[model samples]
Target: MRSAHHPATGDLSLPEVMAALSDPLRIGLLRVLADGGERGWGELRAPVAKSTLSHHLRVLRDAGVTRTRQEGTRCFVTLRRDDLESRFPGLVAAVLAAAEADGVGGGVRLASDAA
Candidate 1:
């Protein structure tokens, strides 16, 4: 299988990262990933179609907010927590805290939450 392109930690741009986090759905995804565990693509749940979810994942990956690994036909994703922290210094934590304070992902029903 072909490998996915991930920008180097140094190559990650603030504008791109901010833009990627601009969407509520993407923030919801981040909230799920913030637990610091890698989650399979099939494991994520959202109100949108699979294609739309895929698009959001791609946006996060391209922006360097997350890392995606392909294992055979499955794709697993994890938030690039260390890299993001190193690059931006507490930005992820602040965003996540703010998201929680504002109930950002409260409406998005994740598969794990359904269990």
Candidate 2:
């Protein structure tokens, strides 16, 4: 199996992670994965089209916010919890907490928002 080009855990950059999470769609994905488990792309219930979804995933992967792996015909995505915690400590938790505190939830339209 060819290993993907994920950054070394220790080398995960703050700016890249911020850029990845700055998008609402990606933030929603991260919120779903906040509980610490892998989620197949099919399991996510976002309203975006498949292509937009793929773009969001690629941005997250490239920014080292998530790890994606192919399981035969299926692809699963998960937050890099350990890596993020190790490098930035409670940053992920804080972000999610703030989102919750702000009452963010489902039904937010991503496609309607111009990025």
Candidate 3:
């Protein structure tokens, strides 16, 4: 297991959080991590390339929605559930519930999955 660190604690500003979610990829990653739990690089690469994935993760991390740490040579990503709750209260929960209500996990409808 990888141990990710947060430099600080608090809810991200609306703009900061929105900027992180601005990319379809980051939102998808959040869903994957939320549904699957503690995913590593290999598990996250299918939706994007390494470089692109890194960028997406960085956005999420900066916005305080996600955190990452080095586990050996691989980096693991996980949602900042506790921190988010402390900072924004219901923000993360609302997002998850909204996704479930929409019957979508990653905020997008797949071809195999209907809207």
Candidate 4:
């Protein structure tokens, strides 16, 4: 599996992070990852094509908002909560809180939620 590029936490830029979070689909993905657990690529649910989803994931990963790990043929993503918090204190929590309040990514459903 080809490795995904993940910028160091200190290299995270506020503008890039803000741009990554600007998309609702990306925000929804973050909502699922907010629990601070690794989620398989297939486990993330959104009203988008698999290719589109891949794009959003790439954006987040590139922006340093997420970390993706490859194992075999599968990829798993996790929110870089600690890294994000360290780089920009309270930013993740604040954006999540706002997204929740605004019902952002409400259409997203987690695989665990399907049970």
Candidate number achieving the greatest TM-score relative to the actual structure: 4
lDDT, candidate 4, 35-112, per-residue tens:
998999998888999999999999999999999999898999999999999999999999999999999987776867
- The TM-score measured for candidate 1 stands at 0.94
Against the true structure, candidate 2 reaches a TM-score of 0.85
lDDT of 3: 0.67
Candidate 2 lDDT, 96-115, residue by residue in tens: 89877875544333333344
As for model 2, its CA RMSD to the true structure in angstroms is 5.1
Global lDDT of each model? 0.92, 0.80, 0.67, 0.92
Provide the lDDT at 75 for model 4: 92
Cα-based lDDT at residue 67, candidate 1: 98
lDDT-sorted candidate list, best first: 1, 4, 2, 3
Which residue pairs collide in model 2, if any?
none
TM-score of each candidate? 0.94, 0.85, 0.73, 0.96
Q: List the candidate 3 regions with Cα displacement exceeding 4 Å.
A: 1-5, 101-115
Q: Model 2: runs farther than 4 Å from truth? A: 1-3, 108-115
lDDT of 3 by residue, 38-89 (tens): 7666655434556876777778887778778786788777787787778778
